[model samples]
Target: MPDAAPPPAATPLAPVPRLDAAALVAALRAHTGEEFELVGPLPGGQVGAALVRRPGRREEVLTHWGGASDATWARVARTGALLERARDAGIPAPRYALVARLPERIAVVQERLPGEPPTRVDLALVQEMVAIAGRGAGLLRERRDVPAAELHLLRSGPGFCLHESLAQYDERTRRLLDLVRRIGTGHASRMAGDDLVHLDFHPGNVLVDRTGTVTGVIDWDSVGRGDHRFALVTLRFDLAVPGTGAADRSARAAATRWLDNRIDDLFGASPDGAATLRAYWAHMGLRQVDWAIRHHGPDDVDRWLTVAAARLA
Candidate 1:
């Protein structure tokens, strides 16, 4: 017999604890009746969790504790339902399946979309996203008669508030919160459509393939009915330079232009719209800062405070 080629090098997978790993394998096998082999840890995101995949399954499965809440679990359910509805409506979305929802853990089996991370945001993709978002908003706005509890924003509200300020918080955070309080209770101007806005639309949240085509947008945790301009503003908030980079200033300018154009084109929102968005940003960002200070250490508290202050400014 011809000699088989040497086995491909094994990837240095991040170690999952022996007990937890065994439990996860058992749970998946029980649910899918197929043994799951460990793949690797998922990319770091705000939500603390790990993921594993099967040898040849089309769906990747995640193991998480925070998402198992009564409210969050429902949101995930609604997300899957919305994606399905969108697909039938000729909207692009990944296939999703809910595998297990245990008392302490939640897992969702989802089809991996075809795309790699994009190198930069292409303007065409931006327009496409806005169009899809517009359609989604229209759908949500039409259904506003639905119970408020069924709304995505209400569920996400408890999750989006700013964290408490820790002792080590920097000066910048103070400025940010002060600005937020100043924003007061202003209402966002009603746009033409009110469907669904992927409130957390950002470059990193979008996926694209090598050809630079957007495959599908992920991270539905923030999907809900709200001002379309809120979505626009969140996408624009990254204008602040991170550390020091050559194009930091240019990036901010481009982001500002993008925000202005999107707001004008999609919503016909005016200068007052900008203030409303900023106020919301300060308020929500401070909520996050508060949560961080309460949960994290000195470094995180300081960083959040500084960013919060900068946002207010």
Candidate 2:
């Protein structure tokens, strides 16, 4: 008998559909039975948004949509509940008017707040924002009901860490990956925590008035239970991104310094503080690189990889 032929390799699944203005408006109308005029696209969202004028409402609201799994949807609902609790406790955050779960996407209609992100993040502004975040963290500290499994970081999909993805990259990235693995393994015990963490807390997600007052914090899609220090790690990385404008560059430098000082004040005296901080930084880099690989171009990948490499080095 002739030898049997080998099975062909499996084809990769197609990327999820990104909802644009038209699609978002349609989804909102279908799910909520409310018509909204498309204002325009909101800037700086990793997941896209459509600013829509709601009928009979004086102020405009935002409809945000992104590719999401069932688990993601569950987490979003949990986050919305957490936000409501935070609001009750005097924490400033967006109120979710509606959360529509479509076939492969989830859309959230939230109250658009009055302020915009600060044009320049000076030290004073950073201090104010940190205080605001601290208040929210206080509310989160009261919650002990979320499951440990759900608290674990989900890196966009099933895979949690970056080791597998880094294997596909060059030697430089792999070296970074090795360091990430070492740090993560050393600090694995500290990964689980009961505090509510806004995994993507950063300047872009922060809304501030003209006077640098934090009016509202948006984008609760990545909220979960973890060390609050992890959130600060994310903020530091966000501030360190290379910027095009002089103000942006200065703000980044200042914000980075402010966050370092704050972290030092909070944890510098602990025996394991430095190691724990390094571990969180490594995790942030891995998370950014993995997400960029899937959603962005090579240059984006290289940029985040470089950031991670520098920290790990």
Clashes of each: 22, 0
Point out where model 1 deviates above 4 Å.
Answer: 1-26, 30-33, 48-51, 59-72, 88-91, 122-125, 145-160, 166-171, 185-193, 241-255, 264-275, 287-313
Q: Least accurate stretch of 10 residues (summed lDDT) in model 1?
A: 147-156
Best by lDDT: 2
lDDT of 1 by residue, 45-157 (tens): 45532356666665363544344678767767777776776666555666665457755666666665667555555455555555665556456655663222212111123
| Positional deviation of residue 156's Cα in model 1 after best superposition, in angstroms | 11
Q: lDDT tens string, model 2, 51-149?
A: 777778855556553557877787678878988876775668788887888776777878888789767766776676666656545455556666432
Instruction: Return the top candidate by TM-score.
Output: 2
Give the Å shift of residue 229 in candidate 1: 2.5
Local distance difference test, each candidate: 0.53, 0.67
